[model samples]
Target: MTLSSNVIKQCALLSSLALFSLSSAMADDHTNKPVVEQLVDTLSTIAGPHPGIRKNHAKGIVVSGEFIPSPDAATVTNAVHFESPATPVTVRFSNTTGIPDIADNNPSSFPKGIAIRFHLQEDTYTDIVSISVSRFPVATPEDFLGLLNAVATSGPDAATPKPITQFLASHPAAKTFVETPKPAPVSFATQPFYGVNAFKFTNKDGEVRYGRYQIIPVNGQEYLTDEQRAAAGKDYLFEELPRRLQQSQVEFALGLQIADKDDALNDPTVVWPETRQIIKLGTISLDTVDDNGKQFAKQTMFNPLALTDGIEASDDPILLARPSAYAISFGRRISGQ
Candidate 1:
């Protein structure tokens, strides 16, 4: 079953109020260190130390692909990839959490991730980072840190209505996120990924629009039934992607969910109505698995803010802070910290 729209909106309101009340207090505590460092520290605290891999979404598989833009793609943005011929891409599919060896079917892996790197001319490139869920829990970097800290502090015998539970109580979106049932996908090729932040797209004509990304599998979204999930192996998702690629190329349609003038552009916690327009951008066809998928993923930093001409980052604080956070994680793994 899915949550009703009314419930989600109400929760978003409650979350906003709760966050507003706690903002001043949190401001004092987070000043001693950079928010990015705090972010890294909180994530490590929650997931424990796992050197040489991503701090989050550590278990992932990388694949090589090319993106073929739709003719109408140029109508939305003047971005090179949208107007040029087929562009080469490096795509990675990953599980949630920092445990590199987490089981494919683990509940913690519900919100699977996909990060795509669009290789443009002159060695420049852009990236899109997304997850299975359409909406994120918090809207700001500080709130995200608070969420992480709450989870990290909440332990077995911590207390009734633990820190995490109390934190979720005040944040409706986070509550909804935690309560949502996310089943395991039969294969990475069968799931859909949605962008968490909105971007401002400018066309050659200088017209601008705000939109979020949506990458849907050409095969459509398919999840394993309870019976199938129970019988699946620990490495099912990772193993299945390679086997599926050998059978045929894995394909997905890249789309943009255009927002109306009144839509909240900066807040990721708000889920736009389903009736909004979704503009088809292109098709992504992945054929080969990276020879050193793990090492390649560790070395690559898929920054959502690493955009090219014609695409600009919105004023979303979470969106703006991502590049710095990712840089810290990349540095740690690259230097073998």
Candidate 2:
């Protein structure tokens, strides 16, 4: 049965209410639960459950692509994909939030997601998971949990200076993150995605450096005007993707924004100066859309920590916690939760 967007939204509201009740009953025992479980539970309570859908970024489309490394890539990292002629990639573009049927124009969906998994030889692979925002809202898993809980409790009817408002007041970085302008993109092909977390790059010669990734579209950034956004269809972004791909391949230049000597390497909430050097690493060319994109997205988990010999994750707490949190969600998705 085909469900209308309104119906889906209403259903999500009901599911969220039910999950909220369940969560409240378990609230007293929350501290004893692992951080991953708490995160998943809070997300489910906030966005509601759609069986077999992801706990976060539930709306996504998978596409096939390849990475063509630049000669400059070898100067910083000896990762297998960077040294190879070409590496096959499975890419997923998604909206923010766990609501599977959120409208393309919804404010909650502004920070779009892009996950790329590089398929190396002999069953080895690495993934780059990024978002439209250049800096993250929080720096640690515990603080992130608090932020999520605040969001869950702050509804339209909540008191003045709601939970989220109070939380934001105390957290300056999160306030900045919220105030960051996230314009609605005309199409996924036109938006740039940022890797908020830093990674350690080690060359074959053993030189080590830290940097964050910036994936910019070759077509350049384009965003909907206020009038255009208001007049656009709820599924405009999703509908535009396949049609655009059919006409021509979408490409993005991948670069690393190198950190300075005194830069904060482990804090994703910290933003480096724009004047910092960016080394072109490669190009991502997505040619075909997966017919079963939704199913593929459901089955696959694009982890940020899935690294190789030359690339290692920094000491960022949020980056370190992603794999476990994603694993819990992946298990539930595959099991038809």
Candidate 3:
């Protein structure tokens, strides 16, 4: 069934209510903040305050590029970026959290982010926001917020049985997310980024397929050794990317990991099996790092839900909540709040 945008929004609201109900029952005096507000607040607590900026993924470098579609791209989807002559693109590579100067080797910097804006016709655009991790820690927005709350409440001086430890005990996927090795990348261009949420793609024949986006670096993956990590500069990624670009363009192939009939469509925390077929859609060629591109990236807000025809959001609550949360971040940043 074709899911409408309104249906996705309602699902997100319902998920929020479910989360609030469960958490409120556990606590005597739970704050009645909106889901978006709670998300911002919890992330702010974890990442510390960064006024007039994103609560997470605040540190980034923007670059300009082009998206060259593969010949068979149209057979899988009719997304505008895959149709043609090369389309201009703007992208941001960011570290996790609000600390703009977090060390490149910090474990907190795992699941690095890549946000892409495909400049389509008529000044319209589509965004694909992804992270280095294949799976997310929580399946729903409620669980995500709960995890953050657990972290916030379980500080160094908290009572016996820390909240985070309790949280991890209950959420195995979250525990796995924490336990997973997230090695520092040699460069942003070398890391494989995955869209943890699934999206529906429609082809010219009107056939719909549910899949996750996997952006594979054309240059192959490379990671820093333990010794290299120990001696790396705090801003190593930011410093390395531009120098790498000066030598040659950075590129990655945009591929979709097609979901099986029995795959969990609504859970971002569950990764689809690698046995599924992958369809290469296009190539992202990042050629230049300029002040203009940087300014544009800073001003632009990339939303995964900002989709065009033939491309639609799945029922994933995390995916549904993103647009609203992004709007809040964008508004705060632009207004200098």
Query: TM-score of the candidate numbered 2?
Result: 0.91
Q: Please give the lDDT score at residue 265 for candidate 1.
A: 94
**Per-model root-mean-square deviation over C-alphas:** 9.4, 7.5, 5.8
Model 2, backbone clash pairs (residues 3+ apart or across chains), number: 0
User: Over the full model, what C-alpha lDDT does candidate 2 score relative to the true structure?
Assistant: 0.86
TM-score of each: 0.91, 0.91, 0.90
**Model 2 regions more than 4 Å off:** 1-30
CA lDDT, candidate 1, residue 245: 92
209, model 3: CA deviation in Å?
0.7
For residues 1-337, write the lDDT of model 3, one tens digit per residue: 1124323443444444445333432211476656666776788888877777777888889988899999878988887778877999888999888787787778887789999988888756788999998999998777888899998999889997999999999999999999878888999999999999999999999999999999999989999999998899999999999999999999999999999999999998898888999999989999888676444544666778778888998988888777666665665665665
**Stretches of candidate 3 above 4 Å error?**
1-29
Task: Write one digit per residue (lDDT tens) for candidate 2, span 187-215.
Answer: 99999999999999999999999999999
Query: Could you say which candidate leads in lDDT?
Result: 2
Clashing pairs in 3: none
lDDT of 1 at 268: 91
